[model samples]
Target chain A: MSWELTAADLPDLARGATLLGTGGGGDPYIGSKLVERVLGDGAITVLDPDELPDDAFVIPTAQMGAPTVMIEKIPAGTEPVLALRTLEEHLGRTADATMPIECGGINSMIPFVVAAETGLPVVDADGMGRAFPELSMETFAVYGVHGSPLALAGERGERVIIDTGDDDRQMERLARAVTIRLGGVGHIAEYAMSGADVKRTAVPRTISMALALGRAIRVAREQKRSPFEAIADTLAPTLYSHVRELFVGKVVDVDRRTTEGFARGLARIAPLDGGDELEIAFQNENLTARRGGELLAIVPDLICVVDHETAEPITTEGLRYGQRVRVLGISTPDLMRTPEALAAFGPAAFGLDETFRPVESR
Target chain B: MSWELTAADLPDLARGATLLGTGGGGDPYIGSKLVERVLGDGAITVLDPDELPDDAFVIPTAQMGAPTVMIEKIPAGTEPVLALRTLEEHLGRTADATMPIECGGINSMIPFVVAAETGLPVVDADGMGRAFPELSMETFAVYGVHGSPLALAGERGERVIIDTGDDDRQMERLARAVTIRLGGVGHIAEYAMSGADVKRTAVPRTISMALALGRAIRVAREQKRSPFEAIADTLAPTLYSHVRELFVGKVVDVDRRTTEGFARGLARIAPLDGGDELEIAFQNENLTARRGGELLAIVPDLICVVDHETAEPITTEGLRYGQRVRVLGISTPDLMRTPEALAAFGPAAFGLDETFRPVESR
Candidate 1:
């Protein structure tokens, strides 16, 4: 079904997208402001994958750099539009719609901004159901979509077009270097594809899923009920299943630094009652979680950290030394857990030693 | 006036270009091989700037990276062709001619390779009468030619186009970062301009000057005369005049390393009879020379090091300890010594503390 997203939907969308980010994808509050500024008194048509013609041309848009840097250097709100236009000019074709490259805080909202500016509808699907650091981590790249012929724009209106011709790793390497030189952040339009390709490769209805998850958490708070239970109930019917609260603890340590265009770090959470500690490691998005030397979840699954009481998602850059938090382990979709998808974004891909094991199995 | 450049001209051109390079611009021998392989039985048309039509499109081509890296990793000879083609496609116009961005070893020869492959005439001019480390340090940029919309290609056939509007420094920063990711060497086509702009801003007749200098040294050697005196005679009537041999010494120390895509180093040469030492500092191209605490020459002037007996120019990457050498200081063209040009390529721009004093004035 086609739906509409207005300024009023931003709060819920931001909250839900933050949860899906696992622990990265930049700050949601800033993304919300950028979207609201451009979306003034307007509604964007959100099309389901089935609603699009097979020949529809879609381009995925997102920001590429350290999330921590985005906090200091907020985008000028014109970057995504410039990036999209640059790509459109390069391709010599008008885009039928815009879509998110990943389901993450700012990345999910960026498409809506581009849609508002270009008057193009947005697809409710995304390449990654949740965020991962590198461009090649997406299902679109893992399956068949080319990530090159990518357009990147800086806040200063500087533009660059990269064409690596099917070398996705080279694209990531070159783009990261450019991003660092662009003052640690750049907006990108990449993975241009057809509607049929999207239908075959993307995780469908992720925006709708995020909306439902947001509403569930909001309603649970209103009824004075456990938001975690509401989250479990909300995701029970979705492709991401087997949600569980792994631990509730006070944050004891967070060691993070922005390096090579990524906010990479490790956080340790100690049980309030003095039980075993939970350690979460992240590169942009959380890649691994362990409790007392036992692996609870790894990448290709979701390891999210949230506020203990309010259930608000805390990004990797926002992790603090003394905050009460809850860690949640959720199983990814079967498509994302397959050997091919795992190889693209698994523990091993991020230089982790262990093989991927599903959250449900754990 | 116009001339033809065949494979027979490459050896002499390489020798003279290496001399003009001062101490950078990659290995001239490798560049000679690359141009020879491409030239085959064909001869490229070398046109003086006045020969170009007012509306002719000209693009300057060069290699951008550390000279040391190019020695171990010779180009596939296809990178410059790819770079020129990429830029031409971006501009939506066929190039009428190609020229050197600078008069330096490999850089001066790269346009010949591009011209041979593209069937484009080679302009007998260059942006820099001599080389500087950064892209913006060119007469073309100093005198109002735009350097953006630049195309770069690596040996792996990776292509990137950067458009920074009029921001030349940003173009250099971004291009350098990309070149590093391209494994320390990339061929670039930049400074796209009209024939009018080339005639107004470029150092004219540099190709002819290099050829004359090469022939002078060769004839002097055959007659058992002084090559240094022959060099002085060859340059006396050109825009670059006031040539003088500053020191004859044995190199006692060389502290050099390849960093951030540049060969940066300092060479200390002690007098043969145990007198004052001459110290030369270089970043890609030699920037400054001092003898016993007295400045002898600084950029926008040329400080070239040559074999004491053979007169073969040694690049910064080729500098070694315990080599006998003679340092020559030559005044640059009056066009390059203007306040604007000095501000672009002078000592302060290279992080030296002294103001630029021409070799003749010193």
Candidate 2:
């Protein structure tokens, strides 16, 4: 399905993105505002992956850096288009459409901003179904897409175009360093591919999923029903095989620190009903969710935190002590469950001793 | 004033470059070996800066990152030519000549290796008369050269081409980050300019000076004369206005750390006769030399530490406690004393409370 996104859709989109962010990707408030300002009364056309022609050029883009830094040093609003232009110049072709690299927090809305600025339609898909901290943890990487010829642009008109050949890990490492130097935030356009590749590798319809998710939360709040139930029901019809409410609790402690250009730490959630506590460790996004020594959710799956009452999504940077919250775990898309994908982003990849277990199994 | 640099010149070149390194620029031992292996029996042509044509394209190249890192992860012997190729592709023109970005440590030998591999002549000049830590602290920066369109290449075929647009400080920051990401070391080719611009901005004949300095040290050692006296005599006819023996001491303490892609620390040299101790603080290169708060030499002047008997220049990375050493202060080239030059590399710029006073004055 195709849709036209207008100014009215910004709030819902931001809300949906935050929910899908799963406690990372920074706050979507600034991105939402920037998009709203750039969008004005103009409506942006959102295209389904199937709608794209095989030969159509496509570009995936997102902000690369620490979430904490992105909140403080708000983007100059020119980086996305600048990155797109730089990429276009490098590839010697114009992009037929733009897409979000990840469906998480601020990144989910960045494509819309670019589309609004460049008059390029946004494909309703993303590389990661939900945000993963590192660039190598993307569905595109699993699908063997080259991450190089990546264009990184800073607000100060500084631009770096990287060509890392077949080493995606090195690309991630280099891009992260560039991001830190660019005031800990830089806009990057990577994995330029044909529309055919997009259809093959992308997590399709994520934009629509985010929109529906946002609408569900809004409607649930108005109806005075539990937003957690609404969220689970909202994700039930998606590509995700399972959506379960993991815990209802209050944040008791947050051991967070901004290190090496990342917001890394742990959040301890104490059950309001006085059962076992849930501990979530994160490097930018929530990596693993555990109850005592047992695992509830691990990476390559969605481990999200939301407000206890209104069910507003809380990003990792927004986590604080004494805040009542609800945690949800959604099974990852089947495409992300393969051995290759698991090896790149599984619990063990993050230094956990446990074997791979689906959120559905938990 | 063209000369062929054969295997015979490697020792003197390394020795001379080390002296000019002024207790920074890392060790040249590995670089010398790399160049020697690459050069084999081939002779590289060294062109005088004045001999370059008006339309000839020239680039100043060097290694940018912490010296300590460079010693460990040795170059794959392809970064220089790779960076040159990347730059040439970006500019849509081939390089006519190459030169060291600075006449310090490993950098002074990199161009020779490139010339051996690429069959390109190296200009007998450099952007800095001696090495300074930051990219902005160069004769090219002082003479209004743009540092952008700089190519940075890593060993893993990772390449980043930066277009910084006249902001040298931003260039330095971004390059440093890129270097750290490239395993704390990267080959950088910056300030690509016309031969006219190269002649106008470059510190001419620094290569010949390094050669002379190296040759003098070798001769003194062979003749059983004090190498320090030989060094002073060798520097008498150079652009440097004065050369003075600052201290004869034994290294008592050395404080150093690789931080933010730089070898940063202070080295204390206690007089062998039990006089005041001299402290040299450095960030990659020695920035200041003082005794009990009395400044002896500060950059852009050169403060070099050498073996007390052999006069072998000890790079900042090679400094060690309990070693008998001699410190020498040499006045900077007139081109580096301009107010614009001082502002970029002066004492105050390095967070020192003192103003830049000429080494010749004290």
Best by DockQ: 1
Q: Model 1's CAPRI class?
A: high
Computed on C-alphas against the true complex, the DockQ of each candidate is 0.91, 0.83
Model 2 residue B314 CA deviation in Å: 2.5
RMSD of each: 1.1, 2.0
Error of 2 at A272 (Å): 3.1
User: What is the per-residue lDDT of model 2 for residues B176-228, given as tens digits with 9 covering 90 to 100?
Assistant: 88887777889988888899988898889999999999999999899999787
Off by over 4 Å in 2: A223-229, A320-322, B224-229
True contacts kept of each: 0.84, 0.96
lDDT per residue (tens digit) for residues A280-355 in model 2: 9998999889998788888888998989889898998888889999898888888888898888788776787878
Name model 1 segments beyond 4 Å from true.
Answer: none
Span of 10 residues, lowest total lDDT, candidate 1 chain B? B342-351
- As a whole number from 0 to 100, the lDDT of residue A182 in candidate 2 is 85
